[model samples]
Target chain A: MTLPAHGLPAGTLRRVRIVGTGLLGASIGMALTRQGIDVELSDSSPTAQALARDLGAGRLAEDGDDAAAPELVVVAVPPDVTARVIADQLHAYPTATVTDIASVKGRILDQVRALVEPRTLDRYIGSHPMAGRERSGAIAARADLFAGRPWVICTDEDTPAKDLQHVVDLARLVGGTPVHLDADRHDAAVARISHAPQVMSSLMAARLKDAPMDAVALAGQGLRDVTRIAASDPALWAQILDANAVEVRNVLTELREDLDTVIGALDGRVDALGVLASAIGAGNEGQARIPGKHGTAPTVYSTVTVLVGDKPGELGRLFTEMGEAGINLEDLQLEHANGQQFGLAEVSVLPAARGPLIEELRARGWTVPE
Target chain B: MTLPAHGLPAGTLRRVRIVGTGLLGASIGMALTRQGIDVELSDSSPTAQALARDLGAGRLAEDGDDAAAPELVVVAVPPDVTARVIADQLHAYPTATVTDIASVKGRILDQVRALVEPRTLDRYIGSHPMAGRERSGAIAARADLFAGRPWVICTDEDTPAKDLQHVVDLARLVGGTPVHLDADRHDAAVARISHAPQVMSSLMAARLKDAPMDAVALAGQGLRDVTRIAASDPALWAQILDANAVEVRNVLTELREDLDTVIGALDGRVDALGVLASAIGAGNEGQARIPGKHGTAPTVYSTVTVLVGDKPGELGRLFTEMGEAGINLEDLQLEHANGQQFGLAEVSVLPAARGPLIEELRARGWTVPE
Candidate 1:
């Protein structure tokens, strides 16, 4: 195990154990381990422990042995296993402060309250980091996974302030921005933003699967961009959606009503587009309200196509030319033939650069077809 | 006006007079004008015409008595102006091939079928290129706007083959892939894919506008990613939704039903996630069916983040390291932060390379969290 190297106060990080070596667990291990914290890893499946160990994420706990009582113990198991593990850990390591990182904190809190001793509740906090990846498993573990990311600490009225500080420090150690919200509010917010998006993206992506090949071929950046997150692991997401089915159902129902209103307008059943438009218009407004880095809105730019060769170094050449021209490209999209005979590359630049960019590219040997 | 430089058999591209100088109109002018085809630009606002002229996209057509007779005329006006302009053009340039590039084909086809001379109908071909941007107006136009994009040419039995060829040629000239479909199918497809997406994106974005700033501040790449397209011009989109109200409404209705099923599952009324999962699963299948460039399935890669300094040429230096390491990066996401601190530089690599790439970066003294 690595020692805390990030200049934390001495003895701040006690050797901690993450009970599951999945995406969240592995990520936490990596972050804490990187900060020079001693991390002990464990999982019910030996394969998970082996994978985490092989990745140098952390040392594995002895099979069926009570783990050394550490300062903090993160119960990063699946929701179905979360309460049971917290209850088990409370019985096994009564001296350590424990926390469970689950998407739905209320349900987990209820289960723990019913299952664990009352005194043990003081040593536990409910948290959820508003972050994730489409992929999972110990192989997908990452460190610094929480840096500048939101770590929602769902504190109850009974949560000890000192214990809260410990969790906050943990978030800081992993580079997460600690966000304190009530259990219900956190779940509701996630229901709207996180969980709802997952379902919507999945449904939308599924629609394209059966579409005609040619029509699907005509699918643009919009569809690809929107449904990118739909490629998540089905089994894991199934469990998550099943656990929080109620809240997710509510959001989707509202969305459906709005959709029907829009449809009704289209069918001349009522003057619905107005209402639909208002709803969607409101959504657009909401999208813009989202702060960019440092809490400012970044200007969105339009993409322009530039055709280039399929040969290696062609991309490098294009980037070099653009760089030399003093053009700051915001984003890029590339499309190549199956066999690589030809392709089109679309690069997005700020509005001010459009005219000069075209002239410069044309002056160079680039063939931008019209 | 410049003649089509790549001289076609005589009369390949007749003079095209566009009545609006917005994004679509200007794009068309730039495409046609670049082909050495003469385009006489027209717009209700002189400023639009001036903007197009400054862009060298086309020559501004003189108004009133000087309205030149065109062999082909395009009413690239908004949906609201479409029918009226078609009537106005029929009175002004009765001999020209008149067509409108409105998104919804059926309504325009239905509206104009009664007003224009029956013989003039042989000259028109309902056409729309499936390409767009978040911005609009003549200044946003590009000569290669339609390059390799899908251009739907809607036709009925009464439509002339010669007229179809003219539009097809126009599409080909602008580097677009022309797809022949009846107006109804075109409408249905657009309703399912394009229109539904717009409404969905707008709705999701709307949620953000009213969100608490602190909550909004916690927003991540996922929300920004999904709602990126929501920054579109609302008034224009409102007009578009109104134009295609029926078809769009139907799709939204179906979506509403799907949402209901989803909600039912949430309320434990049904297998909601399963229903959603099925729908979402369908989207996955559909997405996979969509052919990437040159009839290939796009291979998606996962991201690996490496902390890089926010210094000039830091990106170039990282690229140099990647090249030296012989890592083939499929994509790169540079997390932009306002402060002069470190940034999260995520590189997308094939699944096989994720671990090795991380190790290499770490060995190279790069701050890789994982």
Candidate 2:
């Protein structure tokens, strides 16, 4: 494949070996291969590696092949085996920089330190690309899986500058924007931002297990959003949660304290209203702090809700009209009306575009309620 | 305004009084007025009432008006004062059937029962329209606010058949699908599905208050979805939580028990993996119980994701292509690439159409990774 001119220059990463031909590994191989890099794929399961190779992720990595030693090795495996694989890769490719793509960094870093000598540890860097899909395995791999996603690189003060640059270059080559952080900080950040939220969602969803169907029938967007991640794979999450147990526990403990306060308030404690209000108010403040799309600061977009009929061509016409009007939608949310043959499409755009968009949609005979 | 033929017949509701011209009250008035009913709007705040009047919600309600006695009175007010208003409306219009649209029903029913005699109480029924917007007040009211949404009518064994029929008609006239539920059941349902989720979302979001900027920066769609409703109005939520404190507390206490188990598991308790797996597994089962769109049974739709450039008309062209290809989207989700001028549009279609749709999109020069 011809490399896009905007892609990595030819020699940035001439050859790389990716261990564990799973979703992340194979996807990295495919992306690098597309950029004119020689990517060698390997997995404990030969069939899995062959399947990835067949899918053009990379050529199979055979022993004693007539190829130059890889400049870098990417260890992409489950958290439980990540550390062991990194150690093996470091020993096998003595001259190569080694990076492992595990969601939890601190645990892997600790395990690696316990297993590898200090000199070998210098070649090992822990990284996590904050991108994934509900689906997994080699078949689900995509070349652009990491495009524009945060590829967090965890490094310590003892890390060699040249080695860090190699990892950063690999990240950029695959369309990732790398953010540097320490292993502990990365684990804690993910605990607060990702792992804890997953646990909370599952906990909330578990409550609905025995709920009366009538009660469940009343589920709305709020419940749906809160429980969406509850549908994640349990086995995978089990590994992730266990790997970062300490940090996850710390965050959950703090959450439980607040939960106790809310429970106490519900039990009619003194200043109950104050407790409830403060909890919700704190949420408003914290939720506002999350960055918006394009990794920019949080933006308050103006939403114009249009009534849409549930038909094949209806939404097409609506969006076509929006395009003709030259309004770039910052975001779009479609809410289906219960038991009706229609839905509400909430189109969010810059605040300045709200009035004009509403007027244009209305003029085009769409229902733009005042 | 000409009444649509599908609207309530003229004689069905000759006159209706809406007391409390907030979002719900004003919206009800506007819907009834459009259906050729004589809608008399009243609120404690004359400014709010007048604003509703000027906005075409209804004519102003004044003492000794020539209009015939209202056949019904809707008490649409905040939860704290809903019962008192219901009682007053029943006393003022002794013959009129009265209903209050408060989110929580049991407490209001108990309070109204305490404030009124049995005969007067028989004239009152409780209802909640499962519809609202982030924005409130008369100006934000839409005549179709309740369109195709569930309007739950809470009735008791003592509720008169005629009075119940009147409410059902009113709900239908406002474009709502009436759901029959008792006051206690309604409270419990909302507590489980709405109130408890709100508190949980707020609780989880509150944990992010002191989160390091880097931690918050790592926020992904999972965190975003879990905390979306955390931005809800605190004062309004406080009242809802307080009114249904018992039921909300019950659900939350159960959630806390599961949370404690997971925390214990994290603390290295025996069978920790089993406990964690079951917690997430239960969530999977519960989340699957939520009905899909149109209030149908949960149907798994195949998703076709396409990469669209971030510019005006890009999504329009893509969706227009699908429409022309005769594929109706079951759902659509847009995920922006962080710091990139492109986004992934995940379009969900019926399972049978996934392959054909993917092939069609690829033929149209859009990227569809296999």
Best by TM-score: 2
Candidate 2 Cα outliers beyond 4 Å, as residue runs: A1-11, B1-11
For each candidate, the alpha-carbon lDDT, in order, equals: 0.72, 0.89
**Runs of candidate 1 exceeding 4 Å displacement:** A1-11, A63-68, A295-370, B1-11, B62-69, B87-95, B293-307, B318-370
Give the per-prediction TM-score of chain B: 0.83, 0.96
- Candidate 1 residue-wise lDDT, B81-147, digit = tens: 7977887786788666666778888888778777777776666678888787777888777776676
Top candidate on DockQ is: 2
lDDT, candidate 2, B206-237, per-residue tens: 88889999889878888889999999989888
Task: Report candidate 2's interface RMSD in Å.
Answer: 1.1
DockQ of 2: 0.77
True lDDT of residue A228, candidate 2: 90
Tens digits of lDDT, candidate 1, A1-370 = 6576556555456677789988889888887877777788889898888888788777877655555467788999988889889988877777777888888887788889899778887788888886777667877667756666778998878988767877887787887778899877777777777777777776666656555565565566676667767776666666677777766666676667666666666677776546655766777677767765543455566566787665434555676677778776565566543323456677777788877777888999786633
TM-score of each: 0.87, 0.97
